[model samples]
Target chain A: MIQRKKSLQCRHVDAGSCNACEQELTALLSKELDIQHYGIDIVASPRHADALLVTGPVTDTMQPALKKVWEAVPKPRQLIAVGDCAAGCGVFQKAYASHGGVDKVLEKPDQTILGCPPDPEKILDTLRELMNS
Target chain B: MSEASRVENPYNEWINDNISHKKAGDVWLALTGYRDGQIKSHWLRANGRIDEVKTACMDAQFASLTPSLPEVAWDEREIHDLFGYHPKGHPDLRPLVRTPRWPASFYPMQKQSDDHIEWTDVEPDNPAKVVEGEGITIMKVGPTHAGIIESGHFVFSIIGENILHLDAHLFQNHRGVEKALESLSVQEAKPLISRICGADTVSHQYNFLSAVEQLAGRKVPEMIEWQRIILLESERILSHLNDLAQIPAGVGFTVAHQRGLAMKEMWQKGLSAIFGHRFLFDAMYQEKLAVSKKEQLQQLLASFITQWHKWRKLADRQQGFHDRMRGVGVVKRDDAEQLGAVGVALRAAGVSVDVRTLMPLYRHNRIHIPQVTGGDVEARFQVRLQEVEHSIALIRNALEHLQGNQQDTSWSIPDDLTGEAVSYSESPHGLNAHVMQIQNGVILRYHVKSGAYRNWPVLAFAVAGNAVADFPLINKSFELCYSCADR
Candidate 1:
């Protein structure tokens, strides 16, 4: 059965990030590759998209907005946690004060692309995997 | 008594004399003038001074120290900010990374026996005169943007089109490294450091482990040392690649920038093949591949090198790249020095200080490292590309000498030691400096003065007089690591 692009809006959040993922995401939407290459469309409103391409770790403070965004993304929509912290909380998992990792917030990630701020390979790979299915 | 108290040597006395000291939460402290890595003052912490101006201090919050020793003040405000003591008369009280909301009533670094209370906030003095100043028009960017980079807002004050001042507003507060890292044992913390910069994870990891090893006074097997240098260099290659790619994008080289982005993915794919992730993260020196790092990783690396070489050739030949980069962000040698910039930013500006070469943390000291000088955006680009070349060569060297030794991989740290230790690594961006005050096998307070912070201020000077369009381009030339500072 086709996953049918799920019915959700995607939001990219920065969790103590240096913007590497943001830059790469913009490049995805760049006129060059075009988001259509991966069947990814930029929805102006979060209410319209299905997958949240969440980057960075789930911050203690960011928990409110993260929850809001996830809830805001519409139900049954999947959350794609990108980068190190989203999956395993990367380098920051050691800091005693973090809410532990992204899992502490989103118990089960719909999809996790782990990298130290993953490159387009991981991003594109997942997009392809989703679009194909 | 610190060396400051027992300074019989003339140089040490001079360093101790002009220095300031303070007692923070019952800990003796010393503030010494820093000169070319030498502390140039007789050090002593401030014992609450009566004449504020006489002591180069003005307000209750900060102390003034520049009038006496010139370059010494570089570390003063930083010392004050990180330690929560006073450089009492410091002319600049601008919180470095600590938000203005952070209260001075409590210090985070002062041996926290308990972090029980709700933290109080302090209000910043908003001046009545900020709206209009000569040659200053405030221009704010972010917490949102056109490019895909990290989140944070930057408010730039421009005089006409030139950026006269820049206020970096980063409170993305993921510092939860001290917090995030708590559940992790040394085995896990070892790999997490690699993710700190995303670009310099290997370098960060190496330095982190090296610091831990130093704390424990343990040495890795000579073979692991060799493996570390190789991984460090591979990490350097991609880091520089990202910087090269970003510079073009910053300057509106749409096609060139996209190509750079695509090119980065290719290199990352090369990394992913060997390490199972795009970032080559996780333990590259897996127990099975530990001794055979050179044999296993090197073979894999050699396969990628051929592809990378071709990509480099294509990137180098791109006229559009040449057009966009050339002389943008020209950090002249004198300016670079006074700013005390490190890494490729310094090298591009003609200051050849590579921590890998200057203060090698491991095999870096033993191995031969390459050096370059271009001092411009193009120069930084050239330096990075050449270093990537050198990195490949160094990895090959590691492979030839790759041995399997588990001695260094043991993730053990030592018991409490209140003394201070400073560790410097040549991160892909530049110098990553970490100062640790350890107690009971835990870091009491780890103060980081990363290359990002050093290069960030100088960026304002570089962007000055340049067109507003060039701001992003100029900024990318350095690609300063924010994680180091954001932490």
Candidate 2:
């Protein structure tokens, strides 16, 4: 794992998720979780992101866009795949329109969090580990 | 024309004319309509019913229904793009699901086209139609927006601060879910259906399962029916709360936005504790709800209602929040009905067209259909607020019925299940319908027409004549899901 500073600025890319992952990711911003308190923030632009948080099965239409976003992220960036779909396409495997996961389109993800949609706590835990790394 | 079969119209009061054409084995083009509290589905082939026309032949040409129905315009365009069917005289027949990256010769929905093919990086030519004038300035926004939202392209023709016309381009995230479902078994397709849109999981799963149950000729017990109602209402409350929070966020009302999100978090956590998943992914198949868990749910809801009323009172006091939302993004009743608006949007426009009214499950209960006249952002907001309260009542009533019932919720699928059926469920967004064909327990064809698909065009209609700066606010008010539409 690449060592990161005290703060982790992540950019989320919805490559073709069903939005379940996005829902959980949004939940991370809730007052109960408040992922920002852990020194993790979801940045608006990929340029300022220390990590690229991806979700989805990486459909053919989104493959190029995902690559572009990954390239736009600065060096020493960690690529984190959230949800089973991003890790290995889950139910969408062998889909004609999908590349079947983020790894098939981009380089291997630095970390993969598993679940149909990993719970907010699980995602926050991974982010915290990245922060401490 | 003489060979076309005309089935008996059980709903003659609503459907006066019914026409259908057989387009190969077991597949036919049919029409569905609603009138006078009755929804009629005219099945032309076997036992299958389709809300709109379904032409399955390769390179088939059919008369465009958009000129008459107007609601099926998007359905036709989608049929053309995915199924290689040509709708003659269809207005604005641009690509609906297929983006520019997809090859023109390739139609993904065709059975023969199922094999994997190399995708080309070359951008294909597909242009947006915009109004041209001497001083008109066109503004284009996202297939990828600045916020944490789904992909949708909006082309606006603006003069000064007012929007003249808005052309929305969506389906950039189409993952061929319908095509993918074809190869899976009936039971295997549940996971994909549940994920069609995470927030609408229970609604989608319910619709799909209803269709499957109909195919198998299985009747769910009364206790299980009550369980289903509880699950559906819980999902409705969650969805409404999220939208309630989002609308305020659109208007920059931080207090209500944050408070609403917090309330929503509490509800999600409560659901997670009771049901395994936060979004209730496969909660439909859950066997039983213990009495203790039910009590815990009631306690959570009681506190939530208290918090909700306090937040509403505080938010209503803010005149600025109301000012930004009152007259903005007004969708008239005539336009809403003509364009086939559903869920809160339709009800807000004073149209009583909820699918739940047609279902026996809700009809057995005192389901309230909330209506407002303005059809603006504030009207939609008010409708959603009313619905959250109604949903809570619905859950409580279902729980009351389930107080002593401890029956197994699981139902077995028949081994010889084979047929096609159409089922509709009132998803939080609106009416979600699924048409599925099963051949000996395997899914042959599956088509989903979500409320988002029907309401997307209406959203574009709502945005016109509004100030350019208020676009986000208007968009948030509708809060349609792009993932479901794309799928």
Best DockQ goes to which candidate? Answer: 2
| Per-residue accuracy of model 1 over A13-58 as CA lDDT, tens digit each | 6655534555556556645556665557656445766677766665
lDDT of 2 by residue, B321-390 (tens): 8888999999999898778788889999998766676676676786788868899999999999889989
Docking class of 1: acceptable
Cα deviation of A87, candidate 1, in Å: 7.0
Q: List candidate 2 stretches off by more than 4 Å.
A: A1-4, B1-59, B290-292, B408-410
Per-prediction DockQ: 0.32, 0.63
Clashing pairs in 2: none
For candidate 2 chain B, the 10 contiguous residues with the lowest summed lDDT are: B30-39
Query: lDDT of each prediction vs. the true structure?
Result: 0.57, 0.78
Candidate 2 chain A TM-score vs. reference chain A: 0.95
Locate the minimum summed-lDDT window of 10 residues in model 1 chain B.
B21-30
Most accurate candidate by lDDT: 2
Per-residue lDDT of B314 in model 1: 66
